[model samples]
Target: MWWSKSKVSSISSPLPCLCLLWLIVPACEAQQQDLGALLTAKCNSWNTKTTLSFPGDGSFANVTERWTVFAPPMYSAAISPATEEDVVKTVKLAAKYNISFLATGAGHGYGTTLGKLQNGLDIDLSQFKSISVNQSAGTVTVGGGVRMRDVIDAVFKAGFEIQTGSCSCPGFVGATIGAGVGRWSGIFGLIIDALVSVRLVTADGRIVQVSKTSNPDLFWAIRGAGANFGIITSATYRLHKIVAGANGGGQVMNADILVPANMSAAYFNALQSFSGKMPANLAAVSIVRYDADAGAAGILANWDYMGSEADGRRAMAPILALNPPVVSISTVPWNKLFATAGFGIDPVLCENNVIRDLYSANVRNLSASTMQAAFNKMGTFYSDHPEARGSVLELETFPNQAATSVPDGETAYPWRDALGNMIFLFSWDASTNSATSTAATKLGRQLRDDFVKTSGYPDLSVYVSYAHGDEKIEQIYGRNKLPRLAALKKSWDPRNVFAYNNALPTKYP
Candidate 1:
């Protein structure tokens, strides 16, 4: 048991935001004051709105849980700071106690390195879910705890559009820390590109504002490698006016196409045809996974167009020429894309605390032969291990003109030229372990290697958020940018407190 406590009523304190830290010890040490008492005793100075919870507490299970059970960070206690001041105090207190701490923003950050954080403290940022839109300023300020769905809904309500992650469950800021991407990124550029400023609490417990003029060095790093430096309390992003489509403002075309395994090659070749000159308003994602009805692995493609129905049809003419077995196209508001018609993972794969072995690479080129080889391998693997059928290989392609408009050196993110982001996601239950998990991981790595041979980039380029955690630091942050990032790391996070998820070295290796 995590904490053994005989029955007791929840404590309702007034000072420092009623903390409920009951770290009850085992029988032998029951009489004497223990960690539980110490934690409770320190609650006097916390804010009245700030709350602390332990295992077995109400809502603790849900708040502390992560989307991927694989390599989840273990936490003995969690704190939900009601204000930015509470955030600073919480950080200082955690550091004082020598407890490892990781801010939980939607808690969807999935990487094996997170497993290194055992017996840590969860700085839950859920209370920071605030959104402020300045019509006069044409900017949107969102709290750290905001999710993609929240941003989408808020922008749509305010008659503005913002770029964010495609997935609804992941935190908007958390995803942005790794460089956010989504349906509208093709036209607006990366989520980081829309960044205006950030309210940050550094590793040293100092609250500071980061923008182009203020803390310029940290601003550059925060756009890409933010998690390595500090906890972001809030971020300001430049908002764009909603463009009109056939139905109304923010309304666009959403298409779903299903291709049998036999035609996977043709589907990919058609995708490659429009690679270099992909339309500015188009975003495409294809998933290779099992289809029980077909009893084989096939391709499920989501084609998003932010323009007129005629224009969308004209743009997708080549792809529609294939005449796949299943196809659905409709006009949807850009904000509610996932809900009405998304990549189809929003409802099925959004469940929290599920084991998912994932691997990824950001490639500049797409190869039809490589796609076919991997598709066939995935099909065979699905047949061999039907229990692991939730696994999928996803390919995301968006326009690069807006992303590439910014010089590579202007920000730490070096993948402005990457055309497609590929992820090898293998999902299964706890019952499928050992040999089954091993095979899934092995296949995931092999697929990445095979794609690397034709990825067109001189070196491996990885989007840190989807990386499987086995990749070298250079592969994720780029080789040439390391020395400089390391220097910035020294100045900002000298103690290396933020060293869990693809952390940068304090000194160049």
Candidate 2:
């Protein structure tokens, strides 16, 4: 959902700040100076590896830049705490000073609600970059600041595998907290399923160990709503043996097929065939974008199968029958999956700070008709506004058996049976006109509503990580998981200090 096809220009250099005691806050300088001085002194004397940066400081931008530039949080200053105790000190200081703060690692948080943090102190977790792989224990422990690439490399080096998002930039713990999903999900389950435990720093700066056995309620909340409770100092996840990789990493059958615009129905129909019976190790993602050469939009299906080439070809026969114009297949290490995945070659697809109005929905079935309608809508949208051609609609397919096997009430993350993650993103350059922006939001919501109507569920089941920040509380967190999450919020974060990530209220009335 975060990747793109257009090339983004390099970000401008960061501004420099030179304040003796903490960075200066542009407004209300008098009051802020006192608070900033106190914060700086307290953090400096902690005897921990902590660093501070102001608005214009060189390191400030590194800690604050995010994947999307739209409506990002504004910070007056930032603190990069080294140890878990240092994290606690940072949080306590922010609370004691009544300064709003947000903890970020990799800063890929895309929710618009994050913009709510104004002139807050940023608790940057980049310093907590530690990875420990226990080959004998079949688990890997990582610092909260570690990104997916860090975990992927460490775990793979140990000849073990862990579920992770496709991209390597997002915080490993941050993504899991949002109920992570990717190509590996069909085999093991959502990233949340692999979670073993986490060292969490609560709203009141209390460092606690949460697991199914200790503080189990908090553990349940962190599985999905961890961001709402506190900062994750560190996390440990269950590891699995590599399936097809013998030479260092596992290999898989990967295919990148480009279906003509007219073949939308056919491709979706083939996808529907595998909905309930999708192979546990087979996964596919159909990205809809403007295929300029065709003078219209089309689907780029990136397929991955953890089986032999013959069996992979057999499994993809239904789709291959479409005679797509551009088809490329290969068998390589799992890390190579994205090397040729849809628009993977474009360096911009993974770059940060591109403006995006992304929306996502969890559909219980691969209804072909509904899928076609949405596909057609996106096709027309691209044609109407050439400047917005970067826009795309994605349909991700993964087996739900592994996830559902755990049963409901197992964790705060709902939608164990969701069959697809339909992500619609409206991407455009900064020069786009306001008309195009309005239409993007207008059509984006319309398409999201349409998908929900035929989603095969009575109400919307939203993937919080991919949410547009406008969905109802019940929609983000399943209705069944709300009350419990609300109580947990009240118990752990009653002050609602961490309310930036599609926040759950202190109380659900």
| Best-performing candidate as measured by lDDT | 1
lDDT by residue for model 2 (1-509), tens: 11011111121223332333324343424343344454554223654567767765677788788888877888777778877878887788667666788999888887889999887778888988999999889999989889887787778778877777766778899999988977767778899999999999988989999999999999888887878998998999999877554322476788889898878898889888887888877888888888888889888888888766677888878888878888988886665565656647424556898888888889888888888998888878887889999888878887777788887788998877888889888888888779988998998889888889888888877888888899998988888788889988988888889988888976666
Best by TM-score: 1
Q: Give every collision pair in model 2.
A: 16-56, 17-56, 245-250
Cα-based lDDT at residue 53, candidate 2: 72
lDDT of 1 by residue, 369-462 (tens): 8888989999999988888999999888877878888789988887888888888998887886587798998999999998888889877789
**Which portions of model 2 show Cα errors greater than 4 Å?**
1-35, 46-49, 243-249, 343-346
For model 2, what is the alpha-carbon lDDT of residue 212? 90
Model 1 lDDT at residue 242: 71
lDDT over C-alpha atoms for residue 78 of model 2: 78
